[model samples]
Target: MALTPFLVLGFCWLPYYKTSLVFKLCHSVSEAQQRKMGHSNVWNSHPKNYGPGSRTCRVCGNPHGLIRKYGIMCCRQCFRSNAKEIGFIKYR
Candidate 1:
């Protein structure tokens, strides 16, 4: 069968399609009802591109205490737990 742009290679919905569906649903509601739903619940929920909000730990998704040195994007807790495996030699 031929594949369309919307059709994912795997059985999963892409983020773009998911957010588009949400916007469509929100648009279907009345203006008053849409206003009551709040900005966060409807629009203005786009991903952060800059600033602290853009960076998050790869393992735990924590926004704070991230060790970004040497391209390590994990929080301190995750780093401590998997330090050895990550090639970090700790000296006692």
Candidate 2:
């Protein structure tokens, strides 16, 4: 009977590990909306870019558009367009 409580305690550790693996901000249904709007970061090879190619720019699909090199993610262009409306800064 005492062993049952210890087994329950061990089971608590598994859920903590699962939440750590969730990295992507959008997925499934949100991903579909992003695709329909022509804003996805899928990498393609067109004989340029040299090493491995680049992701489809989420801003304008330019392939070489402004994107962070670390994660290849891009925010909506509307962010820059409505910067002051949203109280954001660039030089700060």
Candidate 3:
């Protein structure tokens, strides 16, 4: 238990390191990772909303995404206008 962090650090710093094994297996994004990471929305062209004011809409709280681009991680009801302005184009 005491050596867990060290072991994890070593794995991350290894020359042959690929993706983080724990993240891939657990499929959980830690708060530290969220800054540098964004989920792939390849299939979710029109992401279905679970509902408004939900915790899952955390991105809406971001002043940058909302003020500058209005590109919050919010549902269609909340983000529809700017989503059009943002001009999302599917390439792949």
Query: Which candidate leads the pack in lDDT?
Result: 1
Q: Let me know the TM-score candidate 1 reaches against the reference structure.
A: 0.54
Q: For each candidate, what is the lDDT?
A: 0.70, 0.43, 0.41
User: Model 1 over residues 10-66: C-alpha lDDT tens digits?
Assistant: 344344355564544322334454356566475757887988889999999999999
RMSD in Å for candidate 2, one decimal?
A: 18.6
Question: Which lDDT tens digits does candidate 3 get at residues 1-92?
Answer: 12222222322432224435644333333445543443443445666655442334343453232332353455454465555665766465
- Model 3 segments more than 4 A misplaced: 1-72, 89-92
Give TM per candidate.
0.54, 0.24, 0.19
Residue 91 lDDT (model 1): 91
Q: After superposition, how far is residue 78 of candidate 1 from its true place, in Å?
A: 0.2
Q: Highest TM-score among the candidates is held by which one? A: 1
Better of 2 and 3 by TM-score: 2
**TM-score comparison, 1 vs 2, better candidate:** 1
Q: How close is candidate 2 to the true structure, as a TM-score?
A: 0.24
Q: Sorted on TM-score, highest at the top, how do the candidates line up? A: 1, 2, 3
Evaluate residue 84 in candidate 1 and report its C-alpha lDDT on the 0 to 100 scale: 94
Residue 18 displacement in candidate 1 (angstroms): 34
Q: TM-score of the candidate numbered 3?
A: 0.19
